[model samples]
Target: MHIFEGFLPSPWWQVWFAISIPVIMYGIYQMNKLVSQRREIVPLLAVAGAFIFVLSSLKLPSVTGSSSHPTGTGMAAILFGPAVTSVLSVIVLLYQSLFLAHGGLTTLGANVFSMGIAGPFVAYALYKVASKAGMNFYLNVFLATAIADWVTYVVTSLQLALAFPFEGSVFASFKMFALVFATTQVPLAIMEGALTALIMKYVVQVKSDVLVGLNVLTSSAATKLREAME
Candidate 1:
């Protein structure tokens, strides 16, 4: 969900900015450390940012002065974990805000918190759980991405409701915003999941070593995947 410029009043935006800055800094640090260890990750990180930029830039008008789009953060989170995904997301969001006017600078912190940090963390957690459960790889990817996309909207709804509650009740406002978002967000999330699943499958077939290098798939898992491909 992309909150337009000036949608969030003063001090609220500042509050979000204050909260997000440290996390963003940490993400940058983590990204740098990872890149130093594996120079190959640089291109992958760029590609991840580009993928997020393209998908998230395609916005559809939604309720509560926000718009809906596929986050595409799940793939990055699955590949590089949530910390690095945060860095990529901030870069993509910044570019979109500056050039595309898709989202605004004032609201960037809030957007980053909801779409970047919150969603990716959930996706990472789900991916771990699914992998440990011995779930099918594609199915795990689908669930992780789709659910992450939905959770992003959910967090956005909470953010909006907190800023401008309905009937003087934050929970009431949360439910209202959530319902409004669910209309478009659900299908969008499912589509995002399907697309991400296909991409992951293609990567597994052609560049499974990348997954192994990132520790996204274990060596045994990679071997099993190659066997299946053959």
Candidate 2:
């Protein structure tokens, strides 16, 4: 959920900017280094960015009272890790803030932290854990993506609580926002996870080798998916 233009006040907005910049700088380095070494991955990067744009852009204000849209960061996080996913998220956020008026530049830092950094980091971590556990490929994607989606909103609610605690109780404010967000976010997360998994399945069919090379899919898993498709 976007915080909207100019919604966040002074230090809070600045503080979020402070928190997000260094990581994004690192992400810039990672992205540049990766592109320099393997320009072939450019199209995949575009696809990842497109996923962020399209899925996140479908903003549903509230379903029985919720907040925003599907973050679509999970697939990108799986494809590029949190660092590079952060880069893609900021790009999309910037575009939306400028032209789409979804979020403001002032709140970009906060938005990025929730939708980009925290969410993607969680997704990447869960994806790695599931991969190491030898979980089924699509199932791993589903769980990681869905949990990441929830975590993003959880973080968003936390941010809001921190900024404006209810009666000096951050936890109480967090509960209020989180409960409201959950109404729509729960279903949104599940839908996003399923959609991400479906997209990944098709991607595996056409670009299994590329995914394998990127370590997104184990060679064995890629082969199995290919065989299943055939």
Which one wins on lDDT?
Answer: 1
State the local distance difference test value for candidate 2.
Answer: 0.87
Candidate 1 lDDT over 1-230, as tens digits, reads 78999999886899888888899999999989988998988997898689778877666444434455667898889988999999899999889889888789999999999888999999999999989999999999999999998888998898898899887999999999999878888878887888889888898889898899889999899889879988
> How many backbone clashes can be found in candidate 2?
0
**Candidate 2 TM-score versus the reference:** 0.90
List the candidate 1 regions with Cα displacement exceeding 4 Å. Answer: 57-68
Q: Which residue segments of model 2 deviate by more than 4 Å?
A: 40-47, 58-68
**How accurate locally is residue 83 in candidate 1, as Cα lDDT from 0 to 100?**
95
Q: Which clashing pairs does model 1 show?
A: none
lDDT of each: 0.88, 0.87
